[model samples]
Target: MNILLKSSVLCASILLAACNSDDQQQSQTSSQTITESKYYQTKTPYQPQQDLNKYEAIPQGFQPVFTELVARHGSRGLSSIKYDLALYNLWKQAKAENALTPLGEKLGADLESMMKANILLGYGVEGIRQFGYGNETMSGIQEHRGIADRLLQRLPDLFKTASTQSASILVQSSGVDRAVDSAKFFTAELIQQHPQLKANITPMSYTSLASSSVPTVEDGGVDRFKLYFHSLNKEQDLATPLSASQQAIYDASQAYQKFEEDDAELINKLNELAKNTQAEQIAMRVLNPLFKPEFIKKLGTTGYIFSNTGSYTVTAPNGESITEKGKGKNSIASAVDAAAYVYELYSISGGMKTELKGIDFDQYMPLDAAKFYAEFNDANDFYSKGPSFTESKNVTSAIAQGLKQDLFKQVDAIVDKQQSHRAVLRFAHAEIIIPLATSLELHNMMQPLPLRQTYNYSNSAWRGEIVSPMAANLQWDIYQNTQGTTLVKMFYNEKETLFKSSCNYARYSSNSFYYDYLKLKQCYQIQ
Candidate 1:
């Protein structure tokens, strides 16, 4: 029987080689062990033949038993072969490159062992079935069938156990339940029951002789082999029995559909967890730096202070004085002397030639006696009293209206001068103070996060003093339009600050005279 199977395998191999040159070439070059034997040689003896008419039907339970056995072993053999071929090719390529490591060699050996076990188990079942009694002669067949029937009833449970175990292993290995072990188990079982009749089977390495069995050869081997070979040819002509259990196993092994769904769910869950963890980590990293005592200490310190004098001074609250009379004498005394000198100069230039040092300039205006007498006489006679009969009552009313108009014109001029003077003072204040104040505010707001550091404004302020001595002029211009309404405009040098500050207090107003005041209030609120 073995010889006949070997001849059939040889013929099949020849036919396969003729059809697929690439497969034959790959098989030859591959380092994977091939377990070929004379088991397919038709000319060999120890084969038996039986007449189809005399042999009874393979029993009703035969299909299911064959299917269960095949499912349990065939899949295992195929998976092992695949793994061996892949590992062998990898090692062979690595060896060619002089890169074969111990790990690679060990993996190759493991795959080889797996393949050997699969092949032995696959063919061992075939050897027992073909050489030993069939279901018609062996009473053990009924018992085996019963066992198979029981196994069939528990198929769902068996599959669940295998799947769970395989999933656990896959998760530990790669965070994915690839079901590789389950696939192997199924492959081994399948190969066991539906062993390819003419395929070669090489003996596997047994751990102990107690677990190994040797096949016995019968006499009249050559003739018997020919008879068995001819009988296989006739058996091929008959309809093959198909098993439903085999189909079910095949369906279950196609795990791609379930794997894709499960994998998506797992990956999504992991990604959500990772995202939350990263956000928390960033918050902690930022918060940790802020809580450091050094940062808090630095923040608590006072900033730059603006003193009144160009140098320095100590003032007593009770109006006491510390008089140091030298080159660094009292600043207040120096300022008073300067003011007196200016008053004297103004008086001399105003045609008051007489020296009047004792006179109080604020209360009395000392002048030349001749000029004063002339001015007093002119004011008494022409300017002060002579407007008595210049016009009629209605004409005087008209004249009074003209005089009121002239007085208003002079008042407008004074108002313009005062506004211009105030603008200069406001610009000076903004230049000296705004930048320092705004910078400090921004520093405080951003210190809690480590996004910014303490600003070094000492150098910047010093540089500004040298270059402009002003924070850079900030001007608020107010004007009246045709509607007798006031409009306000703010400018920093040439740049407008009106709406650019995004400060509510800095809003433009076209109706109220108090717009600049409102804007300053808004700026205060923003800060």
Candidate 2:
């Protein structure tokens, strides 16, 4: 099959499976299909996208040998109190002016309720807990616990061997509380689910495991390309050009803004028409009400640089002309900040029952808005944490190299005779998973966000919702037969995934999601 064709089919399945029946039903009945709109919601606190039962069965008679996973920390509360405080101030101002819609009026009480809940959760007024901001929620704990149980069920032979041979399960995480907490919950549940394995399990927080927070590029550990990846985070003002994919998303966002501002009635009409006729504007319409008009425009302005690429001269206050590179449309911290606040409210509202009487604010803030933010956030990440077609080709390659090093390092340890390890679990933030997926060239991560077209389902392969949602994970299961033929099957966020086409393994066809271990090692140059 053609790479694009195969990619489309696989990506469609993965994305669709990420949604449950309600999401599916909403997609079908709402203004746009998930593909046509292709919005990504960042940290919107959603459940697992893929149904574990629907996962493809392991190929017949392939008993597991070594297994490992790199996972993003599970769903968590907002990273800071800033977003909440910002919106709360806005809500207060809006209330003072009586500018809030009736639904908006309910927000004042809701905000108070959310504040109290956070206080009770030990966040205090500063949103600081013992673990710090953005720590995992209880739901986050259950997420890893559930994932642990499922993995035990999926690879019975691996856990069985660990029990029989007294093999140890090595658990490592970034020192960050969320990542550390994720590793803790996962192992605890793994042990609780299968108590026999507890004696052999050893968990630790390895600074090296948290590559996302500190890529350690300064140590001269990363190669030339890896250095480029490290530079992206600092070269915020670098004139990084956008690809065709990036351009498309930018254009669509522009169009959405244009329609939103100049022809509001038209957008409304289109949305109304979409509701009845399944028109594309329906998704846009659904998302339009989530924000006040001013904030939406602000977000649009902040997001512009990601779509269109170039540098312009800015006149300093001292009347000197300074040629500054355009890192993105908005400053790094401000880009999608509004979306972040909106998502924070969404999560906060989950705890507000009594205070939310007259309004269904969550419905007003549909998944479409989250998807739009997700797309925007992914664009920001594309430069900072993901591979893309940059003016400098080396950016993504650097991070990919770093992650490949970590992957092979773990793989070598797992396969080492002295270790006798059944599993290796490494937990970190979305930063690690995104770049690692790009390095691995799995599914949507393989395609660069284009420069000229909107990154809807049809044009681009990347979908942040499935690729790096909270609790997202990538797993590699090594299997060997009695004849000692070892093979590897990879899974991204629980869905079976194929290696990049360039690294076609001898054991599996291009369409096959499995690969020979030796071929994979050679393809990745995993020494």
Candidate 3:
């Protein structure tokens, strides 16, 4: 059977790394289908994309031997209070001056409630008593917990064998509170759902490749350096481009640096959108409930920015911990800032649907305007992290090198019999996941757009929601036959997916997903 003929083209709702298409008609139709689902609401929060009971079967003789996964942290509240407070401060000004519309009248209380919700996001979630800004919400906890449970279902024999045979399953985290919290929720739920496996679950580290410890990014460890490779945070020294290789990969690369600085295009686009007649009309249409036209007009000329000086942490009497956030210098300046700020809140509110009740941020955000921002944000990310400029080659390729190396390192150990660990689970943020997704089929999703075209919904199939939503993940399960041939299969966001088309499947498997382990390594150009 010709595997290509049987492949069903998935829509944007299910963006998997795909097989090559020789059928131009199919590719054209598939692109049209995916592009239609790509508009608006790009910050889609977590929901499993794959059907649980419909996984493709492995080759008849292959038995699962090892598994590995790298997952983005589950849904979480706003990272900091700056955006919340900035909008709140603006609301205060509107309230004091009687500039609030009837709809806007309800915002003051809603903003306060939103702040409180973030402060308590993960509190009491699976025994976690205290969580604050940038921490997981109950939705987040359940996301990871459910993912772990599903994994057990996917590879029951391997997990069962590990439980009875004393094999290891290593877990690691990026050390940021949200990512670490995700790791905790995942492993805890794994043990809860299948108590027998607790004996084999361990925290992985480089030293002696030990079992039974959860090493954080703060441990000054190489594992963290690999998984948390994105240089997003500079404050706690979490992940930076200070290292020579990272610097070369990120800092010195001009194309990457332009992306780093957003190609200096983000602010201009925001400003342009703010001035557009249709956007202005829609802004008024959506925010009419919140602010008076005169006040909105006055806001058109004002300007301010939020800034953070520093922060600290606090420990509760019972050992619960929360970050003691310092007052950020926050304010809403002009009409543009107000719209952008509300969009920020609106964007975040999507993640808090399970947490915040009784208040809706939607009343302040117009879908058209929200989409304008989402597209720009998506473009920003596309250039910065996703399948970026192929002409430069080094841009996206270099950013994901560390993650690729780590995946190979763990799997190679299993293949070489140098490690007893049956699984390796990594918890990280979306920035890390995006690059990995692109690399999974760099020749496809990462392929450059046609000449003179730029990244946008209609022109590109990549959507942040499909590729790097909260709790996004990629997994690999390896199986071996009695005759000593090992084969591997990949799952993107828990969906069975083919490897790059250049990497053919096992000839004996009737065009199955399984790839011969050694040939698979060669296909990826991994030495």
lDDT of 3 by residue, 67-169 (tens): 9999988877877776666667667767888988777888888777777787666655543434567777777778888999999888888888778755477
Across 416-437, the per-residue lDDT of candidate 1 in tens digits comes to 4322111111101211122222
The lDDT for every candidate, in the order shown, is: 0.22, 0.51, 0.63
Highest-scoring model, TM-score: 3
Worst 10 residues of 2 by lDDT: 1-10
Cα RMSD for candidates in order: 55.2, 13.4, 8.0
lDDT order of candidates, top first? 3, 2, 1
Runs in model 2 deviating more than 4 A are 1-40, 44-61, 122-132, 164-167, 204-340, 347-360, 364-371, 409-419, 449-458, 509-511
**What clash count does candidate 2 reach?**
29
- Give the range of the ten consecutive residues with the poorest summed lDDT in model 3: 1-10
User: C-alpha displacement of 338 in model 2, angstroms?
Assistant: 6.2
Q: Could you tell which candidate, 1 or 3, scores higher by lDDT?
A: 3
Error of 2 at 499 (Å): 1.1
Global Cα lDDT for candidate 1: 0.22
